[model samples]
Target: MSELYKKSLKQIRDLLANREVSVTEVVRACIERINTTNKQLNSLVYVAAEQALEQAEKMDKEGPQPDRALWGVPIAVKDCICTKDLPTTCCSRMLADFVPFYDAYVVERLKVNGAIVIGKTNMDEFAMGSSTESSYFGITKNPWNTKLIPGGSSGGSAVSVAAAQCFGALGTDTGGSVRQPASMCGCVGVKPTYGRVSRFGAIGFASSLDQVGLFASTTEDSAILLEAIAGLDERDSTCSTRPIEAYSQGLTGDLKGVKIGLPKEFWQAGGIASEVLGEAEKAIDAARALGAEIVDVDMPHIPLSVAAYYIIAPAEASTNLSKFDGARYGFRAEGVETLDELYEQSRTQGFGDEVKRRIMLGTYVLSSGYYDAYYKKASQVRRLIQQDYLAALQKCDLLLAPISPVTAWEIGKHSGDPLKNYLMDIFTVSLNLAGLPGVAIPAGLGVESGMPVGVQLLGRAFDEHNLLKAAHRLEQAIPSIGSPKL
Candidate 1:
């Protein structure tokens, strides 16, 4: 085996660019790693080994293109992102056999940049649930400890990078899916500000909150991937027209004169494990030592983030998922009579429990007469949360916060307790509501469980340049969390 899978994205890119390794060698190493580790982790639902090798051989013959930033690199895409001629099941039975005719904007960008798509990773079905257990494809275990969860929705994408199955992977973040999983898997996760990356062909769980994100083992690798996929796309009306920055060029690894704020509410909020808090504190102290000023800021609406996010996210989910009723495409129920029966049976049989729970909750909130009391109120609270972020950013260049209240927990620890799982998202959901950019970096291991703990650095909307710079600097200062034993 080549062991090329162990290299970071940049190293792989360099080797290919220098003609030190053929693209086929790199792709094969990744496929071998996936074959070895994926059974236990369940990180990938579909491995495009033959397709990737064919692409790699062609790339080798054509030679590297200087203009393509990711030339010859092998990367994975989450199951929810559409890839032409490839299965994009979203880890849900509803779309189990669904394959789009056209690539998603991000996937198109990846192809244009000469990157090889290696596989489609597992995720929470329709990107619901805080843990990856909700996927119909079966749970994705944490590589650090097979008994623990790797975090929701984007868990497989995070695990793919953490376990060296691939150099990087694309994921979607709707209320902390990317960052939470990265935290648990001990990898770098970047959730750009909403609209910074197009959502054109990504299957939506919450239209308003969803944004495409990426996972890598290092901050530099994350910046490189983000730069490749981020830009204006006329196909997506919500995507910003602002010019994309050379995010990788901003990595000077210096944080002098930067101001980072700590929200008082986050620290005061109950139930944060001591080890998690300790790691966050150590990160803040390290920032101060790096010549960044640490200041206290207040966001009173922070406490309402979880409640408001659930109502708002679910409401949007209900509307977005209505198209999966078996009337047009996707999985249709057999032996169904009448239109209503087909719709009912298809949805009932296709969606997982978590997806159904959110759909019902969403439908209830958006139903006549109840919309104002539930959906409308939650929207109002969401705006207040956004205002809170806006106000806090005024006092500092960025905000430092915990990614999750605790390290990765044992599998089935919160089984049968969805509320406990929802609460696990308390530290992450607010960033989505605020539409801000955030990068989750490993803050070292938990003192008690010895699992990874992560801290996030949040920047104002569309300000990923500064956000990555600060995160890169801090990443250098913190001790490496070391790769998982897998």
Candidate 2:
């Protein structure tokens, strides 16, 4: 097999721009890599080999287009993002055979910029679980150690980039889905500020929290991809009308005069693994050595993030998923005698255990008498968490924190305990709740587990340019975790 698939997205872009490698060769190399490794990793649920090759050959004949930023690049999309004529199952039996008739805003943007839709990747059912194990398609294995998990629900997207199955992949970050997986898989994952990226065709898990994110091997490559897809879209009313920044142009690799705040709430929180904390400390030291100022900032309400997020996210999920009844296009149950039976039976048979659990919890919270006590209280707490972030950002240009409390664990380590999985997202949920942009860059390998550890840089809403610039500079200062042996 060709080693072309091992190159970074930027490297491949340059190669294609210079006519050093044909688009056909690059796409073929990636397809071959996916075929060889996906059986073991289970990263991609669908591989569009024929369609991708056809598009690549057409692009090869047309030559590179200067106006298109991603000219000839091959990228993967998480299964939840709608792609015309492709399965957008969300990795649940509920949408098993359903294919979207239209492309998502990001997919349309990527195609316009010359990116090939390589395939659809596996994900947690309806983006509800912290681990990809909840997918009906089967769990995605960590590339570093097959027995361990790849943090999710965006595990497959992170694994695809880490294992070089594709140059870059798009994933959704709703309460840590993208960043946590990137941390475990040793990849750069970016979740733009909410409304910064259009959510037009992304299947809603939590309407208020979900935002499309991307994963790549390096921060610069992430910046490139972000610039290609971000901007206003009339199709999504919530998408910001603010001008998009030239994200890649901001990468000067200079952290001079940059102030990075370390939150006391995040660092002092108990239960953080020793090795993970050590790696994060090393990253702080690296930033200090690079002419950056480090300061301590306090965010008292941040500790309540996970609690607030679970309530608000699932409540929105309950409202959004009500459309999946058997009456519509998705998976419909057979042998249903009554309309009520069809609704109940189709849902019972379609959704997995985790999805059903969240739906019930969501319905309960949004119920008549409990609404004021549960969902309403959670909304108030969410506001306080957002206030904490806004106040902290005023003290520093950006905040630096650990992406997850621990490294990837054994596949079934928390199988029987769902709360254990929820608690692991303590560090990442705040970003989604606050609608802030964050970038998770590999810090180093854990001493005990030998798995990847990542540090996230959180910035104010709509400040992705500065966030990506800081992440790129800090990324250079830290030691590379290197590629997975897979």
Q: How far is candidate 1 from the true structure (C-alpha RMSD, Å)?
A: 0.9
How high is the CA lDDT of each candidate model?
A: 0.92, 0.93
Worst ten-residue run, lDDT, model 2? 246-255
State the lDDT of candidate 1 residue by residue for 9-60, as single tens digits.
Answer: 9999988898899999999899889999999999999999999999999999
Q: What TM-score, computed on C-alpha atoms, does each candidate reach?
A: 0.99, 0.99
- Tell me the spans in candidate 1 whose CA falls farther than 4 Å from its real position: none
Cα-based RMSD of candidate 2:
0.9
lDDT of 2 at 18: 91
How well does candidate 1 score on lDDT at residue 418? 78
Superposed Cα deviation of residue 49, candidate 2 (Å): 0.4
